[model samples]
Target: MNALRCLGLGLLALALPVHAEQLPRWEVGMGVGGVSMPDYRGSDETRNYLLPFPYVAYRLEWLKADRNGVRATLFDSDKAELNLSLGATPPVRSKNNVAREGMPDIKPMIEFGPSLDFNLWRNEADNTRLDLRLPLRAAIEARSNPRSAGWVFSPKLNIDFVGLGMPAGSKEGWNLGLVAGPMFADRRQNAYFYTVDEEYARADRPAYQARSGYAGMQFLTSLSRKFGKTWVGAYARYDNLHGAVFENSPLVKRSSYITYGFGVTWSFLQSSELVDVGDN
Candidate 1:
C-alpha cells in the first residue's frame, strides 16, 4: 500500500534540474528501492519497504513526463508555468495499527489539480535555479467505494543545482534539490485520518474532531545523477506537525519524523527522437 506513495515521492525527489539539452523524447526502465517511513503522517508505527518501480519519461510539446510525473501543460512562459499535478497517500489497516485499533481501515487516496510554478531565479552560468510552486488539489479515495477526502493546498520553494557542485561527469551532471513548504488541508481530509468517533473512542483515546487549516511543514532534499545509461538518486524528507489542527488527535504519535530512500535505474530502451528540453 505504501509502496505506491513511496514510489511517487521518490520520483519527485529525483527530479532533474532545469537546463537546455537534447534528450530522448521517451525513455523507459525499471528499478527498486528501499524506504522507511511512518505508517501514517503522525503514527509511531513504521514500515520498511523494498519495492519495484517503473521509470518512464515522455516529453511532448504539450505533455511532459519524467521523474517529476506527467503533466499537461496548460500555460508556459519564460518565468511561469501552469500544469496539472498529482499527489497520493497510502491506506492504513486499522486492525494492525495501535492507535487505530478497533476503527475501520483508512482507504488509499489520490489527489489531482492544477499547479502554478514561478521561476524566481535562474543562473545559467552557475547551473542553479530557484522556483516557487503552488498546487491546489482535490482528494478522493482510491478504492471501489471511493469518497471525497476534501482538498489540500501546498506551496513550496524549490532550489536546484546542476553540474556546478557535483561529482558526476560533464556529460552526465548531478543535480541537488531542496524543497520546503507548509501544507494546508480541509476539515474532511483531516477528519479522515484524525477523527475518533464516540463509538470507537477508547479510554486512552477520547472522541476528537479534526479542523481545517494548518496541516504541517516539510523540508526535503535530494541528490541524483545519471551514469551512462543508469541513474541513481536518494532523498530525505523531514515532516513536522507540531502546530497541525489534528496534532491533538490520539493517533498522532509523533510531531516530527524523517523519511528516506535511495534507488537506481538502468534505461534499456529510449526513443530515437530527441527533443530540446530542460535537464532530465
Candidate 2:
C-alpha cells in the first residue's frame, strides 16, 4: 500500500548533519507495524496497511544504507558534502478515491537522485547544527505498468539537535530535527497525478491539464531515541497546497493536510564494532 511511501519519507527524515559519534556497524532485523495514510497527496480518503519490513543498515567510512535508503559519500568534508539520495511515493487508486472517480490509477513511484549540503552553522557545545539542503529526484513508476514519470526538487533549511539540545542528554534522551521547504515538480510528473482527459471528464469534473510549477510547501519534524535494545521514532509532516499549480485540478480535494506516523523496533542482530566518529 502507501506504506512504502511512508517508509521512504521516514528514511529521508533520518538524514541529519553527520555527527561525530561512534555508531553500530550494522543492525540487521525486521520491524512489524502498520501505516495509515491518505490515498494520495491531497486526498481525504485514507488507507491503513499492516506489514513487516526489513530494518537493515551497514555503517561504513564512506557509505551507509538502511531502511531510509542508501548514501554513497562522493565528497566529504567539514563544510560541505555531496551524496546520492533515494526515496519513494505510494500509489493512487482512482477506484477507491472519490475525486478520481473515473481516472486512471497511479502506481507507486521510486525516486532516486542526489543531494548537496552545506553546513551553515553549528553549536559544538550541544552538537546542534543548521544546514542548507538541496535534493533532486527522478520518479519512476513502480507498479501496474511501470515507466518513468517525472522529477521532483526540494530545497530546504534544516536544524538538527543531538540529545534534545540538553547538556545532560548525552547520558540518555531524545534527538530532534526540523526541516522546511517548498516542493517543485516538472510537467510530466505533475500531470501524472493531476491531469484529466476530456473522455474521462464528467459533469462534476471537467477536463484539465496539469502544469509544471510550484507543488507545495512542507514542514516536517522528527523526534527519536534509543532505549536499551529498542529504538523508537516519530514524525509529523504538514503540507500546504494553497497556491499549487495543480490546485484547480478536479482530482484535488484539499488545500492542506497533515500526516503523522511512528515506528518502534528491537534489534536482535547488531554489530559490535563502533563506527569511526567523523563529520561527512
Candidate 3:
C-alpha cells in the first residue's frame, strides 16, 4: 500500500509540468546550507551539519477572482499543491564515543522522500497571505556505526502568516510562519534501533519496537524574504516525541531537539506564456 501510494504520487508529479503560464503556475528551486539541533540527550548541543535540499511545485489554478479587494486563486481545488523534494544531511559523529552508550557508533543522518503540499490561503494584494501547507514525507534514516536503515512516514503542517502589510522601508520583505505535525513509522523501521531482539536487539538494551501510534510532534517558526530574483529564509524547529519510539531510538533518542538553520533559493526558469486551457 505504501509503495503504491508513493508510485502514484511520483506519477502525479511527473505528469504535471513545472511551469504553467496561464492561470496555473509552477516553481522550482534549490538551496544548501548548515542546520543544527540542540537539546537532544539532555545535552546543550548535539546534531549539527551542512545540508542541501531542493524542491519543485506545480499549481493548477482552478479558480481566480477578486473579492473584498483581495485576489484569490485555488490550485488543486484549494486543498493541495503538487510538490516534490529531495534532501540530504551529512552524518554527525559523536565527540566522546565512550560516553555515548547505546548510541549508534556510525554517523547520524536523514534522507527525504515524495511529499504533497496543501495551501489554505493566499493574499493577492501583495502575493502574500496566510497559508496552511502540509507535507506527506517518507524518510530513510540511519544511526550508529552498524548502519541500520529505517523508514518513516512523516506528515507535517506549516502555517504561514506572511507580513505583506509591513512598511516598505522596514523589513517589509520578511514573512513569518510556523510549522507543526506528527510522524508515523513502521515497526520494522522502529525496531531497527529501538527494539532489542535476540539477534537484532542490542546486548544491554531490553526488547522494544518503534510503535505505529503518534510518534512525535514538531513546532517550527520561520522568516522568509526575497532579494531580487532570489529568496532567503531562516527557521527554528522544536521536536518532541512521546514514549520509547523516539526516546529509545539510537539515532534520535532523548525525546527533544531544536533545529535552527538558514537557506537561499534560486529559481531556474520562468515563462510568460500561459497554459492553453482546452474547452470542456
| Top candidate by TM-score | 1
Indicate the residue-level lDDT of 27 in model 1: 94
TM-score of 3: 0.58
Query: What is the TM-score of each predicted model, taking all chains together?
Result: 0.92, 0.91, 0.58
Predictions in order: lDDT: 0.79, 0.74, 0.44
Candidate 3 has its poorest 10 consecutive residues by lDDT at 63-72
Model 2, 20-82: lDDT tens per residue? 666689988766555566777667787776656767779777887754456667765777767
For lDDT, candidate 1 versus 3, the one ahead is: 1
Scored against the true structure, residue 51 in model 3 reaches a CA lDDT of 50
For every model shown, the clashing-pair count is: 0, 1, 10
**lDDT of candidate 1 over 83-157, digit per residue (tens):** 677767777788989999999998878888898888898864637778899989898899888888898888999
Q: All predictions: root-mean-square deviation over Cα? A: 2.5, 2.5, 9.4
Q: Pick the candidate with the highest lDDT.
A: 1
Which pairs of residues collide in candidate 1?
none
Instruction: Give the per-residue lDDT digits (tens) of candidate 3, residues 63-161.
Output: 221100111232334456444443333332445433234444333344445445555554443333333434334445443444434555566655444
Off by over 4 Å in 3: 1-32, 38-45, 51-76, 92-113, 121-134, 140-150, 163-172, 196-207, 244-253, 265-280
RMSD of 3: 9.4
